[model samples]
Target: MSQQIPFVDYLVLGENPHLVANECAACGARFFDRRNACAACGATGFRKAQVATAGEVRAFTIVTVAAPGVPVPFVAATIDCEGTSVKANLVKVTPDPEHVKLGMKVRLATHSLGTDSAGTEAIGFGFEPLETAIDGQ
Candidate 1:
């Protein structure tokens, strides 16, 4: 896999860093990373697309193992957007698996995707329960 990099100033069209992916104009399939050709139909038709900013949690898993740059017992999930589904880590949720489940309505939240000591930033999306958005009052 390639290192995470920023290809555009606006990560996603709407606001607060929407999870941006790409859809094939030929087959109408969505995939990550900007592509020049459709992976499904081999057509030179593609455009930048963004996933639904809010969706329900289709599945979830907790990571108790440690790895580079990732903390132990972190939560991850398969978030089902309006139509397309993408796997992403859940942010601002309970660090416990018992507290998460399928069909939980989760909202999109932005995170510092990645960072280098030199101060470069990469912005990506995460999931936050709707109440978290309101509780920061």
Candidate 2:
């Protein structure tokens, strides 16, 4: 069996997959990457904060152009997970204006992105419509 690993360090894969962010101790600002100082308050302290699994679409664009071998016509969206803004792809839904809209509820989801020569599988995360998540479709 191959070992599965998250494509990003912030993604936690298990029974319940979720993302963790680096929160500024002083200003409550959250970031996905490590920061020596908080951009909001210039605080040097940080803590690990778990991001909400559910969020609403704040903005999105249907990308029809991409690098070679990459799929086109995918929905790239900015999700507001609680108060944190998350940039991810909308999966399991048609990448059309009629199908995707602002304020659409969504939740975290993961999929396998094949494996490497070392037999290690990489898992990538995305957001899907909340209705589909609830209906298990």
Candidate 3:
């Protein structure tokens, strides 16, 4: 049976993207989520801020172990994007995973990890090796 979906968004299409966040007017602060108040100075005014799509891998770990049906040696990294960044898992592209190092530029892309309770998978985006990032081919 087909599952119903609420909304679907496509991120990190061909090039890296801006995860569009908000910046505080009072304090020099930025956040990924939209908020009515400044997290740093409680200012209600904000401006549109875009986070860097491409970033270097700040940190990573080799998962010698994983959950059921998952493969071991998978890599998880904390991407350091411009301004505010987040951690993401590399998918679809592998570039000498063993030699993967911190501060390596990577691109963001959407990956399929099966449906969730909402029956949708594009709820968020993930990072992939820049070598595999789509470039309007």
Highest lDDT model number: 2
Give the per-residue lDDT of model 2 (tens digit) for 1-137: 78999999999999999999999999899999989999999999999999999999999999999999999989999999999999999999999999999999999999999999999999999999999999999
Q: What ordering of candidates by lDDT runs from best to worst?
A: 2, 1, 3
lDDT score for candidate 1 against the true structure: 0.74
List TM-scores for all candidates, in order: 0.74, 0.98, 0.63
Clashing pairs in 3: none
Error of 1 at 127 (Å): 1.1
Q: Give me the candidate number with maximum TM-score.
A: 2
User: Against the correct fold, how does model 3 do in TM-score?
Assistant: 0.63
Candidate 3 lDDT score at position 134: 53
Per-residue lDDT of 1-137 in model 3, one digit per residue for the tens?
Answer: 43432122223333444465677878868775668888788889988766777888888876777789887666788888775767667665453556587777787666454677755543356677676565532
Tens digits of lDDT, candidate 1, 42-80: 888777777778888888888888778777777788888
2 or 3, which is superior by TM-score? 2
| Residue 63 lDDT in candidate 1 | 86
